[model samples]
Target chain A: MAEMVFQRTKGLQDRPFHYCPGCTHGIIHRLVAEVLEELGVLDKAIGVAPVGCSVFAYDYFNCDMQEAAHGRAPAVATGIKRVHPDKVVFTYQGDGDLASIGTAEIVHAAMRGEKITTIFVNNAIYGMTGGQMAPTTLVGQKATTSPFGRDKNHAGSPIRMSEMLATLEGPAYIERVTVTTPAHIRKAKKAIRKAFEAQIEGKGFTMIEVLSTCPTNWGMSPVEALRWLEENMIPYYPLGVYKASEEVK
Target chain B: MAKVLMKGNEAIGAAAIKAGCKFFFGYPITPQSELPEYMAREMPKAGATFLQAESEVAAINMVYGAAGAGARVMTSSSSPGISLKQEGISYIAGAELPCVIVNIIRGGPGLGGIQPAQSDYFQATKGGGHGDYKMVVLAPASVQELTDLLMEGFDIADQYRNPVMIIGDGMLGQMMEPVELREPKKRNLPPKDWATTGTGGRGHTNVINSLFIDPAECEKHNLKLKAKFDEMEKNEKKYEIYNCDNPDIIVAAYGTTSRIVKTAIDKCKDEGINVGLIRPISLWPFPYEVFEEYADRAKAFLSVEMSLGQMVEDVKLGVNGKKPVYFYGRTGGMVPVPDDIVAEIKKILGGAK
Candidate 1:
């Protein structure tokens, strides 16, 4: 008899993903799902899906979910977590949903030290909206909205969200990770697991900013997208533990 | 509890807590700030959660979250603040979530004044948010009525799986009146089986969402929502006919304006002028049946409001050209006096009395 070495996590539904070819969202979603299943909280978890590319995440997560309006997931999660403190609540958001239109919600959620986990997928471009320039869009990167290759003077430099959020006193854990290789995938999963564990332990806000790739929007092949993200995004984002409180450890 | 003198805003907080509301998310806005302050002080004692959100936009979204989680929740704001909440309200309505919203109306087109006004009548009754939806709007005439409406508002929302708006003027929110926080009569509320409460191994995931990518699916959802609204129009229309017994002239008013109209009707009675009032408590359903019933007997319909003739349109629609419709109003934070309403009533009567 052949032994099965790997299986899909029960935290995720069996539905096929709608993400574009070479998009890193699938890997990130799988990592989050695997962490939830490993943490043994799949049945008690509620995920808030954002209005960007992952708007359909509700159909992908096996647990109960809510689809929030544009830029309102943090506030929505805050509401859920405040009422059901024992339930595991997390928000999966994109760069435009988190760093741009929803800036105030994310900042204030951290300011309140809300006991919720956030999976911030920083793809540096808007995917669902047909590749518009995002707040995390790197300097000199071309987007449909920024046709002039993201002029530094006209559009501000990319926002380093994890580093910025780590400065706030509310967060117990904050990290920046990527999934460009098998080794990186394992590390990203570890970061996601730690964030969820911190949330379950009643720590303050925990967030893992996943530096992802959008191959279709970036006008690159999937392999080239990974190389581009490694050379461009990783240099600016710097994959590491930005902040981790002693209590979280 | 026995009847106690309470401020209108504080009474709302007490009534909501008594109604088993588990959460409140609000922002400080004039004429409605006291309610949030009261909740902030009282919610913890009742084992409920109260949060002062960064903005009205955030507060309403928070209400959406709690409501989707199958928790009774609410938010409150005045006119301008309510404007900020319209986006979230539209989403909540589209998603068919149960929550209560209180709007202590002040003057507005933009940042008008802190004084009481009925300018938001159209915004409340009409869809302020960008969507084809309806909210069961209750326009309470006094502090006691405000208390009563909120006590039952949560149940009304849950029963229909829709948002409920309790609207009052700044005067109604600030005035002190004797109110008994009565235990609401039991209602047959539908179970919140659709709430996103972690499934608990329920064999299927319950998603709280309003996004329908397919146009056909979206249309179907819209029709389903319309059916619920039609049910509300049929079953939830509430109004009080005062001195409407074979009246010579009829007056239509709601919320704080209705109280002034009532006083005007009494003054008209002293002069041997038979005047009647059709006070609509449910503003969205508009109590059109009462207007239709009184149209043949009443010579004219006077729509009294604090704004420049908003509800008059609804009155005209209800009267259906059978009786001449006239509007009397004060604007920009001005409250109408009984004498002014009386004068308008006499003017519309054409000195026949």
Candidate 2:
């Protein structure tokens, strides 16, 4: 008999991901699931799925789930959290869903210091809507909507959500992380764990901003997308904890 | 409970509490603001959650969330605010979630005014949100009826796994009347086994969603929804007949306008003019049967409304050309006086001869 060195996270359903080739959403999803199972809240967890690429996250997560309308996951999560305060409620959202159309919901959820966790996946472009420009899209990046390469004057610069949310008094912990390499994946998972831990401690709102890659949408090979994210995305969205409430610390 | 004098808006809140509703999410909108304010003050004492959402859109979504979690939840707004909530309402209807919505109607077409109006008849009875869906719209004419319908609204919503709307104009929301806060009749509600509470090691995960990627599956879902609506039509259609015997003309109205029509019917009686009233309690599964029954006996059907005649189309549909259907209305925050309704009734009667 061969001893197994690794196994799939029990938090995820026994099914293959439908993500595009080289898309890092699978990895991020696995990391979040692993953390939830490791935290031993898998049975007590309820996840809210957004309207973007991960809309079928309800099918992926092993625990109970809800699919929210575009950009309304935070509000949905808030409702579930309020109904069952002891239950672990979280929302999985993409950049276009969180930073653009749902900006008001996200900001107000943070402002209210809701006792919920949010895993915001920032690929810098809209993945599900056939690669439209997202609020977090880099200024010079090209998208179907911004055909002329994002114009700094016309479209504004990429928004740094972790930095913006850090300024609010509601959040207990806010961090920006990526999964470009083995070392980075470890750090990203740790950040996700910390965010959920802070939420479990009843500290306040906690969000982990995962800088992800959309290789097909970016018109790059998976390898090149990783390299591009490290070189360009990292410089703009620095990897570190933007805020950590004293109580959580 | 004995009858107590209560504002219509507060009575609605109290009625919700009596009906086992545990959650309320709403935004402040005129003529309906008191409902949320009352909830905010009283829900905490009842171990219920009350959240003032940032917007009507957010409020309705919050209601959606709670409803999906298997809680009896609600939200309230006026015409304009209800307009903003259409998207969430559509989503709730599509998802087959149970919740209640209260619309204290004010004038509209865009912030039209704060005064009472029935201009939202089409939006409410028809689909306001983009979808092939139906909400059981209850038109309550007085504070007591508003209270009674609101309590029953929750049961109706849960019974059908659909949103139930209780609509009243500003006058019904703002006025004070004696209401008995009776314990609602018990219902054998289905177990919320589909709710998105954590599975707790249940064999399978529960997902609350409305998206059907396959058109074939989507069509089947639509058919399923239509079946629910058909059931609602068969069982939930409600109306009241006031002096609806063989008469010169039949008056069709609902909500605040119906109260005025009643007064007009009384005044017309003094002049020896036999007038009848058909007050529709449920606006969506409208009282068409009543119209079909009296179409030949009544010389004409006069549809009086606070809007420029939205419900008249439904009246015509019910009458089916057997008798003429005439429309009389006052719009833009204007209320029709009983005397005016009486004059219109006489005019229609005189014209028939």
Candidate 3:
């Protein structure tokens, strides 16, 4: 008898996710699932799914999940974590959801030192809503809402979330990583794991902001999208640990 | 148990911590402002979360977030501040999340006053937000009861998977009295299997949500809520009957005003007039059955309030027009004294000097 080795993440069924082709959300989702599986905390964990392409994340993560109003995942996660501090709590949010609509919630959650992990995906442009410029959108990146390219004169510059959040002393750990290739994906996984580990260790507010590619929104092929993230987005975003106690030396 | 002098609002805050409610989100609002102030000092000692939210809206949503995660949570505000929380409260109710909301009500119709008033009776009883939802409304007439009811409010909220509201007047929130709190029971909430903890091999992710686009699905959810409410009405209706033995008149009141009415009933009895007091503990079910029973025996009923006739209408309906229900209230931050209520009770008794 052949060893049966095929199963989608236990909580996430095998349905095709709603993310656009070449969008890195699916990869991030898989990474999160793998971490949950590896830690043996899947049944004891709960994820707050954000509104965006990842709105259907509840269907993909086998653990108990909840959908938050746009950008309010952090606040919701705070609630869930406080009620069941023994349970691991996390929120999956997009650039628009976290940086735009959910700005106050995430900031206050961090300020309060909530013992939760946040997986913030910074894809430069809004993927689910069709190519609109996001708070994290690069200055020269042309989005549907910024057809003339993002103008610093009017639209303001891209927000460096990790840098800004790092300035605050609330978070126990903060890091930025990319998922452009297999090696980068491996590194991204390590950072993601570290963020969750911080939460498990009773550290407060660890966030891993993944610099991802939105091929459909950027009007590029998957290859070009990855290349574009490397050439343009990474230069502005700078993939590395902006703040971590281990990196203090 | 020995009684200790305590303000109603302060007692609620202490009782909540004793009840294992470790998270409290609130903004400063008059009358009930002491609640958050108390929690700010108490929560840290208990290893709890106490945050002064940017606004009442944010505070309530914070409670919503925490409660959704299956944590024991609470919030307190005055009438105007509670008005700001209506949106979040509606969302909480729609999602059937368990939590506690305390409204130390003031005169209202809009920023009416900072003094005590029962003007929010309609809002508390009839779902204060834009949905067909009901909160288990608990009205406390004394500081001791406020402490006890707040603990009960948390249990009932968790039991029914809905928000429970403790509605009091400003006087109830500010006034002090001796109270003896019972030892809290251990919280036995089943592991929040549905909370958004990282999935540890659970068959499916549990989702807490209020959005249902499909009409049939929405209707089904509404019916489930209605069934729970019907059960609550049958099992959770609570009221206290005082001097009901062969009384000529019954006075319907609650919260701070009820205590005043008690004093007035004593005065009326001294003057050779018989007046009974029906004080509702669970105000949402409104103790209609009790009113119906009293209506058959009494000559007339008078609804005493600190606001303009809000609960009087409910009393009239509860009596089903069997007796004339008259309303006498002092609005805009004014708390009518026992003498004022006694005068009204005498007038209703028709020239009983």
Give Cα-based local distance difference scores for all models: 0.92, 0.92, 0.85
lDDT of 3 by residue, A23-115 (tens): 898899999888887887888887888888788787788777777777778877877777778888889999999999888888888877788
Cα RMSD for predicted model 3: 4.2
The DockQ score of candidate 1 comes to: 0.85
TM-score of chain B of each: 0.98, 0.99, 0.96
Per-residue CA lDDT of candidate 3, range B217-313, in tens?
9999999999999978987888999998888889998888888888888888899888898888898877887898988888888888887788888
Off by over 4 Å in 3: A1-11, A83-87, A123-159, A178-184, A211-239, A246-249, B25-27, B40-71, B107-113, B183-206, B211-213, B243-249, B267-274, B298-300, B342-353
- Candidate 1's error at A125, in angstroms? 0.8
List model 2 lDDT by residue over A1-249, tens digit each: 999999999999999999999999999999999999999999889999999999999989889898899999888888888888888999999999999989989998998999999999999999998999999999889999999899999999999999999999999999999999999999999999999999998999999999999999999999999999999999999999998999978
**Residue B299 in model 3: shift from native, Å?**
4.9
Residue B214, model 1: lDDT of 97
